[model samples]
Target: MKLAELAKELHITTDSFIKFIQDFDLELSECISTDFEVKEDFARFARENISFLKNYQKDLEQPKTVEDIAGNISQPADKVAEVIRKEKPAIYENGVYRSSVSSFGVDQKLGGDYNFVYNYFGKRMPLAKRDFIGYRDLFFYISKALDPFANENTTLTDWGIHRPAGIILYGPPGSGKIFWAHKIAQIIGYQFKEIKKYYLGTSFVDGNETSFNDFLLETMKQEKVVLFMDDFDNVMMERTATSSVNSCDEETKEIILHHIDRFEEEELLMVASANTLTGIDREILAPGRFDVVIPVFPPNVQERAEIILYYMTKDLSDEALLKQILEKNNADHLPFWNEISARMKVFSNTMLIDFTQSLKKRIRTQYLKDNSLDIDIKKHLQPALREASAKLTDEYFEQMSRFIKDISVNNYDDFATRIENLKQELQHYRIVEKPRQAIGFTHNSDSK
Candidate 1:
C-alpha cells in the first residue's frame, strides 16, 4: 500500500505518520520503500502501537517549538536549537520555529530514549504496484491544484479557485518536466498535445500552410485539451537591451498572450516546460496567465535507487539470468541499490536510464561468455557509472544551479526538505578544485 493509503487506514495525515517515524529514532528504510510503499514493518508497527501513533499525530497537529520537541524527546532545548540550525532556512517568528522545523530530521543526530519500539519486517512492495516512484509530496500538491477542476461546484470554486488556465513546469533539462506536463493532462482529464515548432510559427499541415494563430484557435475549439510547449523560456524570454530576443520567439510569445485569456472558457490548459523561470517574460507570468509554476526536481538518492531498480528489472521474468543476478546482489531490493544511488547524487533521470542501459549490456555480455549467473554486478556497474557521470558537466551543473535558484524563490515552502536534501548532495561536488563559485551554490547563511 502507498503511504497515503496506509495513513488513511490509520486515520492520520501522511505528514503526521512521517513525522512520527522521524521524531522517534526509527529506520524509515525498514518501514517504507523508496517509492513510499508501506512495508509490512511499518504497517504492523502502527497496528501494534495504535495509541502511541494517534497521540503523536495529535501532538504534530499543534505548533511545536524547540522546547516542545526537546520536552517530548527528553532532550535539552539548546541541543534542539543546534539540531534545528542543521535544517536550513529555519524560520523563526515571535520566538518559536516554523512548522517546517517541527518534525526535525535529526536522523540520529540527537540521541534520546524513545518510548516506542520499531520492528523491522516484510519485503519491499513490487515496483509494478506503485503508480510512480517517489515525489509523493509533488503529486499531492498537483492533485490539490486540480481539485477545483475535479469538483467544479465545491468551495474551491466558491473561493474563486478555478483550474489554472496555464501552468509552467520549470526545471533543469532531463528533470522530467514534460512527464509532469502529461501527468497534469491526465489529472485534469485533458488530451495531451505537444506544441511543435511548426505549430509555433508556420509549417505545412497536411500539405497546407498553417500559422501558429490558426493552430491555437483550432485547439481552443476542442474541449479539455492540454497544449504542451517545451523549452518555453527560450521563446518567452524578457526583451532586454543586452539580449537579442528572437523575432520568431517574440511573435510566438505575443500569439500566446493574445489567446491565453480565452483558454479557461474553452476548457483548454497550456502547460509549458522551461529549464528555468529566470528569463521568462514577466508579462507572460502575470497573475491570470502562466503564473502557476511548478518545479520538477531530479530524483533524490532514494528515488534514484527505485528508478534504477525499476529500469534494470523492467519486463524481466523471475527465471531470467539478469533477474537471478540482481537477486544474488540483492539489487532487487532498495538496500542493495542504496549504496550505488548514494554516490549518484545530483544525477539526472536521463543519466539513471543511461546507466541501466549500459549495465544491462555488460551483464548480458558476461552471461553469454560464461553461461553462468556468477557475474560481478558491481564490477559491471563501474564502467556504466563512469559513462553516465560524464554527463554531469559544468554546463549541466550551471543549469541545475539556475533551477535551484528559481525554485528557491518560487516554491521553497512547498519543498523545504527536498531543497535542503538536494543542497547537501550538491555540496559534495562544489569541493572539487575549480573557479571560485563555479557551481553557483550559495552558502546557506547567504542563501537563506
Candidate 2:
C-alpha cells in the first residue's frame, strides 16, 4: 500500500505520519524505501538516523518494575481483597440440588394444600421446631455427645448456639437419610458442605481436587458448620453390594476411615449418611468418631397414610377400604400401596375423556361434510351392563332380597322388575365413575 494510503488507514493526517516518520529521520516516501521492504530504512538515511532510532527504541521498550506495576492499581486493593477472602473463603463453589421434604420427591401440585406437607419437612428443624417422631431422643443424644467437644473447641461466636454434634447417618438409599443429614445445617442456617474426598486423597497441590482441601479446611474454620468428606459412604460400601460392583474404581476404603480417625474438632458440626453403618468398619463409627449414629426405616401403615394424606386432593372416605387393603398388605413387608398411587383413579377417566374428544374431531373431519360423529357415546352413554353372572347376581342383591320377599308373597312381575333395577345399579359401577381421591393416607371403601 502507498504511504499516504497507510497513513489514512491509521487515521493519521499525512502531516502526522510525516512527523512519526521524521522521528526516525525518514520522509513519507523514504519510510516506504523499497516497496517490498516492510520495516527497514535506506542505508544513507539510516546512517544519519540510527542513533535517534536507538533512543526511541530504548524509550518504548523499558518495562515497569514490580513496585511500579503494583502502584498502578487502586491503592490498598490487597488489604480490601484479603478481608473479603478471609471473611468468605475464595475456595467455596456453590451448586444447587433438588431435595424434598420426605427425602424422595413427593408428587405435589403448586398452589395447593399439599404444598405445606412438603414444606413441613423441607427446612431443618431446630430443637424448638421439630415435630417428627424420635426427634426428642435424637436431640438428647446430640447434646450429650457434643458436651465435651463444645466445652473444649467451641468459642464465643456471634450466635449463641454452639454445635457439638458431628454425626453420620447411613441407611438404604431413598430412606430419607441424606435429607435429614443436611437438614441440620439447614436448621441452623449454616452452609451445607459435601467434602470433596477426592481432595483429601493425598496432600493438596497435586491437582485441583486435592487443592480444594486447603480451601475447604479454611472455610470450615469460619463457618458455623458444614457437611464435609462428601463421599457418602467410605466403609459401608466395602462389604455391601457396591464394593463388588465398583471394585474397579481407585482409592481404598481405608483412606476415608483414616481421615475420620485423624480429624480435629472444628466449630462446624459435621453430618454424614450411608445406607448401612454395620459394615462401615468400626474405625469410622467409633464413639468420638461419629458422635451418634441413627438408623431410619420406612414408615408403618399409619405413618404411610399420614404421608399420603398430606399429598391427597380429593379427601375421599375409605375407612373400610383401607382396612381391607391394609389387612391384606400387613402380612409382609410391602414397599408401597399401589392402590394409593396418585395416578390410579385419574387415568381411566382421563383416557376415556380424551379418547372421546379426539373421536369427535376425527368424525367431523372424515365423515360429515358438516363434520361430526353423530352418535356420541361419551356424552350420552351412562353405565355398562354386567357380564359375569356372579357380578350380576351381586348387583341384584338388595333387589334380589326384595324380589325373593315379593315372590314369596306372590308378586312375581314386581320381583322381576326389582331384579332388573338391581342389575342396572351394577352397571353404574362399571361405567367408570370419577374416582374420589383418598386425600389422607388411606384407601377407605367409604368415600371420606
Best by TM-score: 1
Tell me each candidate's TM-score. 0.80, 0.32
lDDT of 2 by residue, 169-279 (tens): 543334355556564554445677666545544553545344443554565567465564434454235454555524412243444344443344455666776544434
> Candidate 1, after superposition: displacement of residue 422 in Å?
2.4
Candidate 1, residues 1-448: lDDT per residue as tens digits? Answer: 8776777787877777765555553544566654456777678888887786676666656677777778777777787777766553435433564434544344236754343463244454477565567776677667666666665666354686766889999888888888888888876678999988867778887899988999899989998999999889999999999889988899899999998888989999999999989878999999889979988999999889989999998898779878999888878787888888999989999999999999999899988899998877989777999999989998998888888899889998777768888888877789676666547767888666
Cα misplacement distance, residue 425 of candidate 2 (Å):
38
By lDDT, who's the top model here?
A: 1
**For model 2, how big is the CA root-mean-square deviation?**
33.3
Candidate 1 yields a Cα-based lDDT of 0.78
Off by over 4 Å in 1: 1-58, 73-89, 92-124, 155-157, 431-448
Error of 1 at 72 (Å): 3.3
Assess each prediction's global lDDT (C-alpha) against the native: 0.78, 0.37
